[model samples]
Target: MVESFHEFVVHRSPALCRTAYLLTGDHQLAEDLVQTALARTYRHWRRVRDGNPEAYVRRVMYHQQVSWWRRRRLVERLEAELTERADTDHSEATTLRLSLDAALRQLTPRQRAVIVLRYYEDLTEAQVADALGCTLGTVKRHGHDGLRRLRAVAPELVDATAERSTR
Candidate 1:
């Protein structure tokens, strides 16, 4: 463990930034997410120092993100980072990645977080539930609902490959 909270933040911020980016999609929002989570972690540094401080910080980020989304639902959707990148080749993979990102933004915050945690983070359903401080059934429902919403918005994002992998 790091000797101080500042040391811990300096060491882990980059990774936390990446996780925040995955959770929020937008780069700026990802930075804000990391800042806020770290702030809370700092506040309880003494208590968390002996345990899994990183997990504590991550849980704070997820809950704070959902709360922020709920409060901001009435505001206009911002897409500062949605513009196409010129560097990427116009391949099917590029288009699919872009489509998936856009489609992810359409779901409710809880559903979006559920999808990121379950699929992108490769966390099992029960682990996701634990991380989100929710019940197993809640995680299952959110995963199901998120997938259903994605199918309606971007069917290409879901395919028989996942089904075959399971079945």
Candidate 2:
């Protein structure tokens, strides 16, 4: 157990921030999420000190994010104006990365959360289920459906050789 809130924040902020960023897909939102989670954790620090404080904070973040999604009526419109730059190396990897990002955006929040928890965070299905407060079957279903959607939407990222050979 962390002895102090300052120590806890100093030790766990980076990992928490990374998870927040993955969950929200926006740096500002990620930072805000982390701060909000940490604040909640601090309020309940004495209570959670005996248990897994980090897990408590992570749960708060996930629930808070889902709550935000529930309250959001308007779809976010992101318009980035990129200035033209000199020719830069654009490889197949870059193309695949962009495609994967776009495909991920198409998924429902629950499915995207499952993907991030299972793959990006390298958590097991059971662990993910616990983290997301769902059942093992639910996690498996989401993961399966999420992967299926990714394969359909971004087949090149899913199977590089198969795609390249067909081209």
Candidate 3:
């Protein structure tokens, strides 16, 4: 537990960046997201420092990513294809990671957030809902839809036979 805002940031920024990267798929955007969230957290540090500051920062990042997605909707850029040489021996895990990244990029912002929170962050449906400031039903809907889409886009990444948990 960090007592100061600076210490909190130093300890949590890497995890925040990873979450932001999972949310945005772009490194620059991820950095900006974490920075924006941290700035907001700093503003309320006096009030939030003694509480769950990391959760507060994550909530801010998720909300900010959604807002940024809305603004970028009209001017979304065409991403360049990932190129791989046949001669280069790539590990299966690396291939899966790349595939998952691409698959995640296809989801809507809310769905992507749901997926990242639920799986990458190991957050439960209730936790995801709280983080996104949404209902549990909304979280469930997005998670279901997102998983369905991921299976369609990258079947190798998501198992076809796995059942969605009711919890």
Candidate 4:
């Protein structure tokens, strides 16, 4: 267990940032999400420190992301870094990443959360449902719809022949 909130942030911020970025697809929004989540975690530190504090922070982030989405404040901004072609060797990988990012943006916030939590974070349907405060059926429906949209939008990123996990 982490002894201090600072220690927790130091060790976990990178993973939290990755999850936040996956959820928002925007660095600024991702940063904001993580910061807000961390702040909330700090407030409830005593209550959650003995338990799964990271999970607590993540739950806060997911709920906060949904709240931000509902307020129509999640306006995606294109960073200048995206337009620069500094590395030609990694262009293929970059293309695939951008394609996936675009495809994710096509999903609703809930669907995006479901996909990120299920695949990126590698959570089960039940865990994802619990995290998002929804039913398992809802998670499954969002996961199904989200994947179908991804296939339609970016078939190259998602292999059609790849078998999905039974879980």
Candidate 5:
């Protein structure tokens, strides 16, 4: 069991850490979050190993993210970092990616989590709700609210999409 768990962690850790980094936008904090979540998951391995352990760890990560947000006022500090860089390379796709990432950083942690899970991970509403331990309605509300906020902040994206449609 220990060997199997170790192997599982080795294989899944990168993806988990990537998700954590996207959720937090801080490498050190993401590492801590993933480590903490994995540790907690390890404690209940027997019960969770057979089930969707990835979902269990993701839930732990989401809860830990929320708790961290509540406990610290770090989001304000992050705003400056989010806007500090503007992608000015030749690649339009890279610029759009950077712009979208910056826009996502402006959202609240829960809203960001909802957006990441729904869009990046392409999880269904029920899956997102289950992962976040929220009701499906809350998941839908968060997704709606997050997109609304993103649209408000990123009118350029909307304009770009409109231009594409017309062309």
Candidate 6:
């Protein structure tokens, strides 16, 4: 059981951390969140081991993210300061990733979580609600609100593919 759990962590850690980073917009915080979620999963391995362990860990991550958002005003303050230092002359994909990350940071935590779970993780609305411990209606609202905010902030992103093709 321990071996299986360890293997699962090794396999899933990168994707989990990436999802967390996209959700939180901080690498260190994302790592910490993934670690905490994995630890919780480890603790309940016996109960969650046989059936969708990844789902259990994802729920922990989502709840932790929401709790962190609720509890930490300092996080946003620090992020505001850190944004000024985020310049990079990387590839277009990298730049777009950064832009998307910045746009995502502007959203409420629930909205960001819904976008990550729905688009990034490719989960259905029902699955997202189940993962978030909210109603499906809430998930749909968040998704719509998140996309609306993204479109509002990054109008160019709507034509991103066309822009890239011309470049």
Residue 102 of model 3, lDDT score: 83
Model 1: per-residue Cα lDDT at residue 159: 66
RMSD of 6: 3.4
Instruction: Provide the overall lDDT of each model, using Cα atoms, as 2-decimal numbers.
Output: 0.81, 0.81, 0.85, 0.84, 0.85, 0.85
User: Per-residue lDDT for 14 in model 3?
Assistant: 94
> Is 1 or 6 the stronger prediction by lDDT?
6
The numbered model that scores best in TM-score is: 6
| Tens-digit lDDT track of model 4 for 1-167 | 34598899999999899999999888998999999999988988989888888778888999998898888865564442455556655656566677788878888888999999899999899888877778999999999999999888778776623423332
What shift in Å separates residue 17 of candidate 3 from its native position after superposition?
0.8
Where model 3 places Cα greater than 4 Å from the true spot, the runs are: 1-3, 74-89, 159-167
Residues 115-156, model 6: lDDT tens digits: 999999999999888887889999999999999998997676
Q: CA lDDT of 136 in candidate 1? A: 93
CA shift of 46, model 4, Å: 1.5
Instruction: List, in order, the clash count of every candidate structure.
Output: 0, 0, 0, 0, 0, 0
Number of clashing residue pairs, candidate 2: 0
The parts of candidate 4 lying over 4 Å away from their true place are: 1-3, 73-90, 159-167
lDDT of 5 by residue, 2-64 (tens): 887898899999989988988987789999999999999999998988998888999999999
TM-score of each: 0.78, 0.80, 0.84, 0.81, 0.84, 0.85
State in Å the error of residue 164, model 1.
13
Model 1's lDDT to the true fold? 0.81
Local lDDT at 127 for model 1: 76
* Tens-digit lDDT string for candidate 2 (7-122): 88999999889888777878898999999998888888989877877778877898988888789845753332223567965667766655656777667888988998889888
